[model samples]
Target chain A: MTSDSRLSWRDVRDRIHEHILTGRYGPGDRLPRDADIAEELGCARSTVQRAMQDLSDSGLVERRRKGGTRVRAEPVTRATLDIPITRREVEQSGARYGYQLIRRRMAPAPRGVVAAFGLGASRPMLRVEALHLSDGRPYIFEDRWICPETSPEVNDLDFTEESANEWLVLNKPYTRLDLRFYAVSANPRLSDLLETEPGAALLVIERTTWVDDAPITTVKAITTPGYQLLTGS
Target chain B: MTSDSRLSWRDVRDRIHEHILTGRYGPGDRLPRDADIAEELGCARSTVQRAMQDLSDSGLVERRRKGGTRVRAEPVTRATLDIPITRREVEQSGARYGYQLIRRRMAPAPRGVVAAFGLGASRPMLRVEALHLSDGRPYIFEDRWICPETSPEVNDLDFTEESANEWLVLNKPYTRLDLRFYAVSANPRLSDLLETEPGAALLVIERTTWVDDAPITTVKAITTPGYQLLTGS
Candidate 1:
């Protein structure tokens, strides 16, 4: 597209970002009003507003109610991560997905589970331990706890046919989600379960969900060695 | 916040979300047009539109240009992660921040770096290794490769006083970013540098950036044990 061509919001955002990258607008420098930018670029003011909103969302700029927009002094690299159901993840990778339920029982919530849910006290919950396989090889071992008070239907249905990861994601809609990533050295038990050697480094993805301030579930998905989690492009 | 009070866009969103959570609107169900929902809720069409946009952004709904909106058939959990400059991250955590430059040199880009940048062939790049400290303890060890062709200013400035991580973030504005997280077993060299034991599991955050298809830099930030990366709340 030529410079004089009709500009989309992305085009407008790129032009504004070009100005900033060229040092025309230094750190913490105030940007022109949306109207002025629209006039200069021969685009609608709404287009400029959209571009500004995107830049603001990406942590490149800060927008104030009446103070206009300014470049962020400390720019942050913002990324979006989408964690899909393990079955979907494996299938999308062109692998035959398999799941096995290792154990299921009703037990008191552990201290870690209680802290994750921010519960007042420990309570009875359904605990599920399962393994996700890709092409008959171990992929991820998940330890999940379901709050029966919030999801009573889980108690009626056995997870032998389908994994809880797929069931809860399809049935329950969470208002809030908490995600964390860390690393752990696989112990002998975990190594045996994941079919990896002991002392191997593994990535752990911890996810906790809540629906309208009520606990839904908390899960720790420990992946086998060399597994990588990538952000959505 | 009574039910009959003037409703904001957030109120409209929560009401619609409650319907989905309560099974009133099942998966893959088409939502009413924005205008109809606005009239039923006694709000403006623009307000309903905003609420729908929020839902769509969070992976709860799918909005088609000509087909209108519907609940996502398979919901994915979406989260935003903001990785600020390491110095800012340390200071924001209420800890004193320190930086040390370990090595800086110009070398031929490695195979991994070339693949990260999607380059046609290997090229000479500026390689820098640095350590970020919190309260005099190693927080993160970064091994970075900067494309001198894209950033020529790096040739003049020595990264002794300020870290390349902080400097590049402030100076460079990338149009594209690639992020990956994985675990690594600390080797003897890495263990000595990070002051950790051998075979310790470490979290590695690899980031690659480009400015409009021109490669900028790629860095692998290896964190010490017990470090966790959390999603933005």
Candidate 2:
């Protein structure tokens, strides 16, 4: 690509980003208007807008109408549909991450799980309960349920090599996914797995991924005591 | 707005929403695909897609490619930017939410705030600190910085009726906001406001809001002993 083509929206955006990050352009500074920026860059305003979009996506900048551009002051944590791979995270942390499949079954999911997934009383589902570990320490207890109607092939898949999310991403392409977070008092079942007293405060993450509006899987994770979740939209 | 032009997409969307909320289309149910739904409704596939988007946005439906649509097994909590609203939240709990404007000053924002707003060091800024009471009990201590050079009218406004956010929204429209949540050990200042012992756990929320690319406000809120954040996203 020639210089003109290389003068992409990203190029304009990065330049602006560099200025903000380097303090060349301070926070609360009014950005040059679209026409002015386009003129200064000798490019289209659309290109500048695209760059701003990229910045916004990364949580690096805040955009406002009529007010203009501003540098974000908070530490931006980029987490997107994080693949809940404690193994990968622990390994990256130079700590050992391990998992043991405590139990596995192909029975109907519990009533709450069924209701959450809108599964009927008759639909047979796969449920897996396991204790995930970090260097031989209990890390998370996972209770997972999946609708065979969405992926009848789950019964044939193995859990030892990769996570369900990894398998689904590769074998089953999902169009969308929803992740939820909340704090709850841990129950007897989870307290033991997490090494916390029953009724201990805990952070809960529930995820339901789908392919074209069809249910793929539902996984609820209970983390160890004192785990903090830092995520972004 | 006409009945016919009301668009089959919206009609199907409303009907589907009512079904889900009413428990007719329970979770985990496979939704008819574009062609099937379009045929049943005597509408275009595009219409079905648009309707599906609404369901997806509302955290009620999951969409996957080739898999089809499914009711969410668990409703995901939508995460807000978690704007610092101590009074509203504290009072909502039936706790007395109070504010003591401990200090107020007009000067150039600190380097961080100035840089955040892309403003010169000499630009006028406002600094305000206050305490929030929950049910007649102190719940939060807030410290805020604003770039009034970007919002000249803010200097003349009163914050007694609404909150800082409400005031800013009414006076200065923002386009983007960044929020961060973290756990910190309380220091003396925070401990004093929250009425907690030093080193107690305090949930901190830091935020920066902007318009276009211009930074407007920066805030840090320190919470009392009982702080809860609930979100499904």
Candidate 3:
């Protein structure tokens, strides 16, 4: 209803992107104002604004409060990754989802866990070791540490019927999140747990979350060999 | 000036996000209309719209064309990843950047390359093998294939002085991109090139890009051992 023309925001965005691809607007070049662009393209200003927002979110442009929009001097390959709960992932993959709780106890946070949370010192936290399976095959081995001070409910519930991954993701909303991906060689323990050969290359995803200034949890999810993580388009 | 008060879009976003965190609106619950929320909060409807856009982008909610906005039933941990040019990445890390072109020739697209582009048949493409160095040490080994039909200018450029990674990123823009990450064990050839021990676990970042439906390029950036890719935030 905003525009009489049939041009959608996606069409406007593609047009602007074509301008950049064809060098009409080079790097660091300022683009026309939204009103000007809208007039030129015979569309509504809101349409142009939506297109500009998309370009900005994709790292193709920089928009300032009053300085207007400009092409980024250096473009990056920006990607969005969506990591779902393990059970959902397996189910969506057409596999029977299974989980096993290996170990659970309270222990002092390790040096790595402490560092991951950016804590001043180590503290007693709940440590959980679990394995996710797909079709009775080992899928991922998770080593997690939860802060009881932040979520006291964790101390009462045993993580047997439900996984900490699913529980925390649903109950605990994080204000800040840190994610990193790396590769690790499977050692004896990891090989045994994952049912893979020793020295097999494995992909590792480490995640740390915080609510305001309080650390919630930090986890390292190590996958079996040949597992690949893909971007969500 | 949208709001008479000092509330910004981020303030509105956090306030609404807090509602979700406190269980005021559970998963799959529809939110109040933007105008209603704006009236309640004494802010402009556009402010609420911006907040809802952010929440939707972060996968916390879903907005429909006419159904309004609702909390996502299945929540996902969404992260944004920004991969800069190899040269810029090294320079930003305060290291001297180096590049080496191992080989450059025209070859038939391999099975993996064809599959990456979702092409039905194999065709001749420009194959470029290169190495990126940090402080004169092996950093990333890249195996790339460029579809000359999509990017004919690639046939004229020699990748000795400037890397293909930098050149393509600066010149050619893609409409679509596919990114995947996995682990690979260094074989004898990979070990010799990367100067790592055999069986060392290395992270491989595979990227395929397309302009509309035409495939632009596909590259596998094999990173050195201990290399880590982190989220932008």
Candidate 4:
């Protein structure tokens, strides 16, 4: 809708935004031409134009000079999806941080892990289970699987010294990383590790790092008590 | 260190990134002069300079010709945090969508809700609680708080028919929204509302919206599993 609060442009802008968000007008759906909308809504074309501009600026719609306007094909790009190391995140929030690697084992990748890391189902991978702490409190339960073929150096690692993220950055530096972010319901193990109640809400981040285009490691980190991530242009 | 595979640039860049990330050289912390770093790392000053440039390009550092360089204070500002609705997120992953409002309350704001909305602790507020489904499965729980002081009309709505976000965009208009993203441990109540085991990870979004300078709403939505938020330049 037009955000012309001073002159009722808001009414039109909101109308358009509502139509698009509610799926009355799906992505790629063309909007009524300004003149047509003005007639349909019984308002001035100028108001419709103003509202269209507002929606376009917020990435709700895409406008072209003579091509008309269409709802966006996708929502505008968003923020960090796969949660990253709690050490970095906590430090970002001005908190002190520490980490411990509980164990490192070589095991066959689980089905979910294999698919997520894009590895062969039967591949034996290096798995590391670790805990990240913030101000001495358990902050994250991180479980990771590394493709042995991608980083053979996993055999020489010592989890008690530093985090896998740190070790890989310095020892087996990756060339690229794929990250996924989302929310999940906590399980008993996660709740116990995070010191929260079971079935509580937690933010989960999964990442797969690649070296020379080869998938290297898949890391999953879950956080408790939640925190906000901020990003802007 | 530099990213030069043949040179030492890669190591230099990684070194600098490590320092910035690990708080060895924190926000607003200045890097030593080019000569100093080159000497310390046993690399050419040009290589160190290139490394710094790489960090700058990645939104991790700042550099000036002769003034040396300093770590950036506003790291999150470079984050691309976009607000999204359930349909869009689900469809992006080739999944289906469904939405339902399970609970709705119009009463005094709770402790966190009141403070976030700037409403008095005893002031009345409107609260909306709902679950979003994907392919017939619970995917998200939305807990939204609207300050009656900001929009007195919100208390008279039936959100079961439509989302409060949609209603606000249609009936109540606003500009300027402050969004923060973070990992959150789910509270026990949220665990049950979302049908997840307690303490499961959740994707939490907190938004404080405004028109001009008056706050309108403070919304916190928690989403279920397989919901990944991703963004890039």
TM of each candidate vs. truth: 0.88, 0.50, 0.89, 0.59
User: DockQ for the candidate 1 complex?
Assistant: 0.64
- The single-chain TM-score for chain B of candidate 3 is 0.87
Q: What is the fnat score of candidate 3?
A: 0.71
Shift of residue A100 alpha carbon in model 3, Å: 1.0
| Candidate 4 error regions (>4 Å) | A1-85, A88-96, A105-108, A120-125, A147-159, A167-177, A181-202, A224-233, B1-59, B62-83, B90-106, B118-124, B131-139, B147-160, B167-204, B224-233
Residue B133 CA displacement from its true place in model 3, Å: 0.4
Error of 3 at A194 (Å): 0.4
Write one digit per residue (lDDT tens) for candidate 3, span B102-209.
999999999999999999999999999999999999999999999999888887899999999988886666667899999999999999999999999999999998
DockQ of candidate 3 (2 decimals): 0.60
Q: Please give, for residues B56-116, the per-residue lDDT of candidate 2 as tens digits.
A: 6544578885688998765442333323245556655677666666677887667767654
Best by DockQ: 1
> Residues A88-197, candidate 3, lDDT per residue (tens digit)?
99898999999999999999998999999999999999999999999999999999999999999999978887999998987776767899999999999999999999
User: Can you give the DockQ of every candidate in the order shown?
Assistant: 0.64, 0.07, 0.60, 0.26
lDDT of 2 at A214: 74
Per-residue accuracy of model 1 over A4-72 as CA lDDT, tens digit each? 458988899889888888888888999999999998888889999989987876679989977999998
Candidate 1, which CAPRI tier?
A: medium
| Candidate 1 residue-wise lDDT, B1-233, digit = tens | 34534888888988888888777888899999999998889888888998887787667888996899999877888888888999999999999999999999999999999999999899999999999999999999999999998899999979999999988887776767889999999999899999999999999999998876899999999999999998734
What docking class should model 4 receive?
acceptable
